[model samples]
Target: MVADAMELATRALLEANLGLAEQVITGDERIDDARSACEEQAYALLALQAPVATDLRTVLAAIHAAESLERMGDLALHVAKAARRRHPAPVLPEPVNRYFAEMGRVAVQLARRAEEVIRSQDVAAARAIEDADDEMDDLHRHLFTLIMNKEWEHGVASAVDVTLLGRFYERYADHAVSVAKRVVFVVTGRMPGTVSDDDL
Candidate 1:
């Protein structure tokens, strides 16, 4: 549901909808609760079943993925709060709004692809997620360039707010990529850094 939350947060920012921003903020509690419950269940299984090897790794990956998902929710909440903080005024300038809108769309796509990678254990999808994250990083850099340009007239306050929003979206994509990497690790039994193309 964090993907849905991210979409709502993006909608809130793009439209300057205070109601959607408030919903994203309040909806974070649900993500927190769900993460807690999933973690508790994972721990219970580990303790009760004494799972070994692949089973243990699967459980560990699930817990880690849940944490990543929760972090994604928190990042989405930050985006919503930034939007609400600006109220009717957009946190992003009109010229840069399209970049942010594209970033938001890419973020949601990464989340969806991450879900597919997790369920299918498709190494190609996992690798694709990392590639998608690179796109997000490029967008983040472009955002910084816009903010830091000498001709920028949005003022320091606007620049700071835009920077934070960019970071939130960038980090959100990072977490989604991390989730995909974890799935690869679980399926292949190779740690993230140790996994080569042949292994994937």
Candidate 2:
């Protein structure tokens, strides 16, 4: 289930990066379906296996992780939609595009790492996922600064579109980090990091 969710997330990110809004939306529906199936299966495991303690944590974490991946897919679709709406504007500045691409790359990498940690029950690998998430957060902050400064300034509409694109990408990274944190809790029996209370 984690593998399937991760694959969908990877596809969604790739589609958004390529400006395939319609395809991203279509893919999101499938991801939503997979999320629902995973949720039901996790609950079924709980009822049938009578899991307890750490076992229970693993099942619960799987469900949460699936939901987080679904949210990441949704955010990717949002970015694709924003891209579609901003059509005919000049392409984003090279630097901004480069940053966005790098952000997406990090997101995909983290998603893959999270899946590996879950599959292998490797707590050490989970720590690496957390560290990778920190890098993503830093990248997001840098992109936000660039967008706010109107470094490219295609125009008012284009600027708004780019700003929203950056936000969507950032939110996508955040959800991936959230999934990694859940993996940490499932493996270690405790949440590993500080999270802001403020809404993004």
Candidate 3:
């Protein structure tokens, strides 16, 4: 769902297609529905199954991951709306379009890795997702540099659009990384960097 939304939102920006933007906005409803269903089922299991320890962690992690994924979808929808708001005026100017395009591709990659880590609980893949998120963060910083530089020609409106676009991608990557971390926690009975007094 995040992948599809990212693709549509990217296309809307690149093509300046209001229709695609609207499609992305409307498509988010289904993603929301899917997330709600997942959460509902997780809660139902918690209520009825009386799961403990590993099972409890699994359910909690699932709920957390689903929530993160839904937020990622919302960020994609925001990107689409930005494109729609600036319709006929390019949201992303030509020079900076490649950076956003690359961000979209990396978002899709991280989202896919997030799903893989969720299903397989592979710690190595979860770490890889975190590394991919670093790339997204670097791209986001580069975007800020471009817009903040005095040579920027697109002016305030374009600057606002670019700023929002970079944030959407950055936040989407954040949620993906969160999902990956939740997967690690579910598998290992611990978060990546935290420790209890006993471990200390």
Candidate 4:
């Protein structure tokens, strides 16, 4: 659902498709609900069972991952609102639109990867998401440079939109990284940076 929101937000921005933007805006509540359900279920499981070792880790990871995913959904919602606010005028202009589209694609990819890691608990795949986040960071820096460039003609408003939009995408990727790291913790019995898998 978070991935879908990111994709729709991108499509809405790139195509100036008002309907898609509306869908993203309206559908955010469903994401919130789903996130709530995940947290509630995880809590219920913890309350009912004295889970040991891997089981305890799995439940805890679910709670953390659900929170991260909810944050991702909120970031996507921000982008959709930005698109809707600037409808018909185009929130992104020309070449900058291409950069945002790339950002969008990477964000959606991260969200999907986070989902997969949560389900499969693949530590290798979780590490891959950490690497993927670097691309998002680079793209975010490029957005800042784009606005600072003297040749920029989109004016202050579009520049502001671009900055906020870039941040939204970058933060979405950050949350995905958090989710992946939680999966790593579940599998390795330690967070990614605290201890190496070989040491554990």
Best by TM-score: 1
lDDT score of residue 167 within candidate 4: 81
For all candidates in order, the CA lDDT equals 0.88, 0.66, 0.86, 0.87
Global lDDT for candidate 2?
0.66
Give RMSD to native, each candidate: 3.8, 3.8, 4.4, 4.3
lDDT of candidate 3 over 50-88, digit per residue (tens): 899889999998898888889889998999998898898
Ranking by lDDT: 1, 4, 3, 2
What residue pairs are clashing in model 2? none
The CA lDDT at 57 in model 1 is 83
Q: How well is each residue in 1-200 modelled by candidate 4, as lDDT tens digits? A: 99999999999999888899999999999989998999999989999987989999999888888888888889888988988998876789788988988999999999999889888889999999989988988888887888999999988988888888888888888889888988888899985663212110
**Candidate 4's error at 100, in angstroms?**
0.8
Q: How well does candidate 2 match the true structure in TM-score terms?
A: 0.79
> Model 4 scores what on Cα lDDT?
0.87
Q: 37, model 3: CA deviation in Å?
A: 0.9
TM per model?
Answer: 0.94, 0.79, 0.93, 0.93
TM-score comparison, 1 vs 4, better candidate: 1
Cα distance off (Å), candidate 4, residue 2: 0.6
lDDT of 3: 0.86
Q: Provide the lowest-lDDT 10-residue window in model 3.
A: 191-200
Q: Write the per-residue lDDT of candidate 1 for residues 44-113, one digit (tens) a residue.
A: 9999999988798889989989999999999999999998999998888888899889899999999999
Q: Which residue runs does candidate 3 get wrong by more than 4 Å?
A: 192-200
Instruction: Give the local distance difference test score of model 1.
Output: 0.88
Clashing pairs in 1: none
